[model samples]
Target: MRLRNKPWAKEEMSKYPHIVIPNPKECKGNWNKVFGNNQPIYVEVGTGKGQFLSGMGKLYPNINFIGIEKYDSVLVTALERIKETKQENVKFLNEDVENLLEFFADNEIERLFINFTDPWPKKRHEKRRLTSEGFLRLYEQVLKPGGDIHFKTDNQGLFEYSLHSFSKYGMILNNVSLDLHQSDIEGNVMTEYEEKFSKKNMRIYRCEAVYRD
Candidate 1:
């Protein structure tokens, strides 16, 4: 996916310090203070346009939703969406996935969502995939025991690789769906990419991988 340069993105993002967290790393273990409540926090990596997080926040008002996106251009759009929704429980971090641990401490996050992430398909780029072992280890450190990662993608090879990766890491998989839209799963929030892919009749793969103690 090509990202068009939005020269005003950075300047626009600064306007909403409440929605776009300026210093996420400083909040680390004190995310409850940031949200001013003890509600469980759910994070979405590579949150493009903030559609999923916004929708989830509306459905689950008791849960705090944080979105992490590296690109200022992409993240600005998500920030705008959250502002329009006026969702107090929804926030964003304009940060990289590699620095995930820096923003949250052990057992801080309750759940994670990885939806339609870039499928770095080259064998050489396997480590860059969000479902790769390195990322799984990072997730394990931050999420509470029994926390689950909900993942969805339209890429078949990446889906297969992720299933194998999850099993290799000893994570228990559940609710695996090769065609999510056709499945019986309820309350599934659609991301911008998921909606576009569904319109094209593409199969959406989804699964939940739980972390064990």
Candidate 2:
């Protein structure tokens, strides 16, 4: 994705100190302390423009939601949304998921959401896929034992690849849905991309994967 450079993006993000955590690396394992609560912590990798995370913070006030987006330009949009809503339980991280350990300790996160992450379809780029074993290993290190991953994607090739990857990595899959919009599940929050694709009559695949001892 070619990110448009927003010269004032970083400056704008700094204005929302409550939403955009300052020096997130310092919070590290002490995330509960950052939120001032022991409630479960949930993070959305590749949060995009923050539609999902923002809605989740409102839906589950008890759960702390962090939006991780590598590009400042894209993240600033999320921060602005949070700023407008004045949502207290949400935070934003402008960094790559590869360095997740640098800001969070083992068992620090209770749940993770990978919503419409890039497919990275090339065979040589398999490792770049978030559901790949390489990324799953990283998730295992930071997520608490038995922590779950809620993943949704519209790409069939990526969805199939993720199912096999999760199975190979020994993750227990549940709530599998080949066409989420047609499913009977309740409380399904739609992302910007999800709304756009669903309008096109696209099938949205979704599942939950858990780490078991």
Candidate 3:
């Protein structure tokens, strides 16, 4: 989906410095200070529209939720949603996922979420996949030992590829589901994309993969 540019997005984001962290890199390793607590941080890599992040924050009040999105226009909507939810534990970073390490210290994050991310289906672009070996290495570097990656996607190809990628990286896979909505899993938080896909009766694949200690 082509993102429509919101002319007011930048100004709107600036007004919410506490929620839309302007200088995320400066908070590196001191994220707990940013949230004013030492709660474990759970990061969502492509936190589009903030639905999942805000929802997760509402459910897990003791955990800090940070969403990373590169586009300001897209992130502004998420910021609004978080504000409406009145969730103080959730925050947004208008930054790219590639710079994850720059804003986080080793073992800073307790878990990671990759919800309905771009499939990058072309075989040549496999490296760009969030679950690809290269990205997994980045996740490993910043994640605490035993930190797990929770992934969900509607694309079967990406799901299959991710399973193989995680296996190849020697990560342990658990709670793998070919059809998430149809599964018995409880407490599922839906993203904007996930809700749309599920309404269309599309199968949603989900899994949790953890790095070995």
Candidate 4:
């Protein structure tokens, strides 16, 4: 399903008013100005409810973060989360990820994050999955060469499918974890979905995919 419009809903965030982008279109190819001189920009493509990005922005002040969500209703929740922190290092785009090239210059984004994206389980609907080859091409356009996309999901099927898709695109994978919560990495930020499904004993698969030059 395509997402509708409502830039004001997010634009009106008052608490962490700094997080709200005055004009997202202006940041196009000029994101560096938002983060000061030169800082790494990390993007969360489907930042549902903003739990992860908000927490991450608070934790890493030097790294600039942007959340891209097509759905306005869901993005409002994330906007509200950042409100509590007043983190200036965070921003968002209430737009589809398909227009990534328009929002950013080639090789602009340093890192990408895909967290518990819609699986698009049906074989006929495979193209709808964010990890599809066509979508991966869009990622490559915005992601800096040698840059990486980190993915986390509780769906085994999507993880398996994404693993194949990454390989098909000649991307390199490392630090792949079948069960993320069980790993030794401390202080891992958990999203609302990750916290909910993990209690049900579902295995969480995570991996970092680096696009080859």
Candidate 5:
């Protein structure tokens, strides 16, 4: 799934040099000091090519952003963009989101974003999905009380399932949108996956869920 013609992506990626870590043990329990003073940190679970992460990092200099993407192929671009901006407010992690708590301290994050995460549509594979209850607990353990989970996806079934998951976890849902682009919310940045899916006229689902605990 190489996107060679994306010159903008290439140019943006060329700006930042990446520091890839193979050992999750290295980042474990050290992220609190990485971004300097906590600084209202936010993380995107699967930041493909870093489109959303880099975009937001540039816009919000006060809030530190971390793009947690396990795939090197996609993360390379994201790393380059952060370097280009000379943005000190962001970092990229090439690792699975499954063990997120090991890398972050308790209630370390202020917000979590799951932009078009893998749906794992098969009934038998439901638990493996990122929005599953098990994964939500990982998020809950790190997100501060009253912190929010903002998610967007074109997958109807995943969106529906996630709604139930959020409610089941005692998270309040607000600002629900069945069609995001048509909404009046300004500066709603589009991720790489979002742009591709929207071309087919797929309805986008977005919501904010507050972590009660």
Candidate 6:
């Protein structure tokens, strides 16, 4: 769903400062302090509409969840969902994933989630894919040793590309599913895209990639 430009997105975001970290860099290595507790942190890159992260936050209050969306318009929608749910453990970041290192310290994140990200299908734009080696290296820098990335997508090309990419990086892969809905994967939190695609009988691929540095 292509979102239209919202001239009021930035202003609307200011209304929810508590749910959106005002100065993310200040929290950096001290992310635990942002939530006022030292709980495991989980982050979702390209958190489209906050369904997954907000659900996870509400379900697992012990873990802190942050949703990163680059566009202010898209992020405001996520923030709206968070607001409606009144989810305290979840926060939204209006920033790019490329600058992930600038927000969190080394080994700061426990788990990373990438769901239905842009495939960047063209060969010329391979590097723009979130699962590209460059992003994986960046993920490694922030993820704790043994921490893994959980990815799901309806794009077969992206999933295949990611599988090879993870293997190329020597990441241990497990629980790969070609059709996630048919699998008996319990505790699955549905993202907006997941719900939309699954209803259309579209196959959803998922996998876990552990970076054992």
Predictions in order: lDDT:
0.95, 0.91, 0.94, 0.84, 0.80, 0.92
What lDDT score is found at residue 52 in candidate 6? 93
Q: What's the lDDT for residue 187 in model 5? A: 75
Q: Can you give the lDDT of residue 210 in candidate 1?
A: 94
- Would you list the rank order by TM-score, best first? 1, 3, 6, 2, 4, 5
Residues 140-197, candidate 4, lDDT per residue (tens digit)? 9888889899899999999999999999989999988989888875667888889898
Comparing 1 with 5 on TM-score, the higher-scoring candidate is: 1
Q: TM per model?
A: 0.99, 0.97, 0.98, 0.90, 0.86, 0.98
TM accuracy, model 2: 0.97
User: Which stretches in model 5 have alpha-carbon errors above 4 Å?
Assistant: 1-24, 27-32
Better structure of 1 and 3 per TM-score: 1
Task: lDDT winner between 3 and 5, please give it.
Answer: 3
For residues 85-146, could you state the per-residue lDDT of candidate 3 as single tens digits? 88999999999999999999999999999999899988898888888999999999999999
| Deviation in Å, model 3, residue 151 alpha carbon | 0.3
Off by over 4 Å in 6: none
Superposed Cα RMSD, model 2:
0.9
Clashes of 2: 0
Q: Which residue runs does candidate 1 get wrong by more than 4 Å?
A: none
Clashes by residue pair, model 2: none
Cα displacement (Å) at residue 212, model 1: 1.0
Backbone clash count for every predicted candidate, in the order shown: 0, 0, 0, 0, 5, 0
Stretches off by above 4 angstroms in model 2 are: none
Q: Which ten residues in a row have the lowest lDDT in candidate 1?
A: 76-85
Q: Please estimate how well model 6 matches the true structure, expressed as its whole-model Cα lDDT.
A: 0.92
Q: Which ten residues in a row have the lowest lDDT in candidate 2?
A: 13-22
Model 1 agreement with the true structure over 64-171: per-residue lDDT tens digits: 999999999999999888878899999999999999999999999999999999899889999999999999999999999999999999999999999999999999
**Per-residue alpha-carbon lDDT of candidate 6 for residues 1-213, written as tens digits (9 for 90 to 100):** 688999998898988888877778888899888888999999999998788998899889999999998888888888888889888789988889999999999999999999999999999999999999999999999999999999999999999999999999999999999999999888999999899998899999999999986
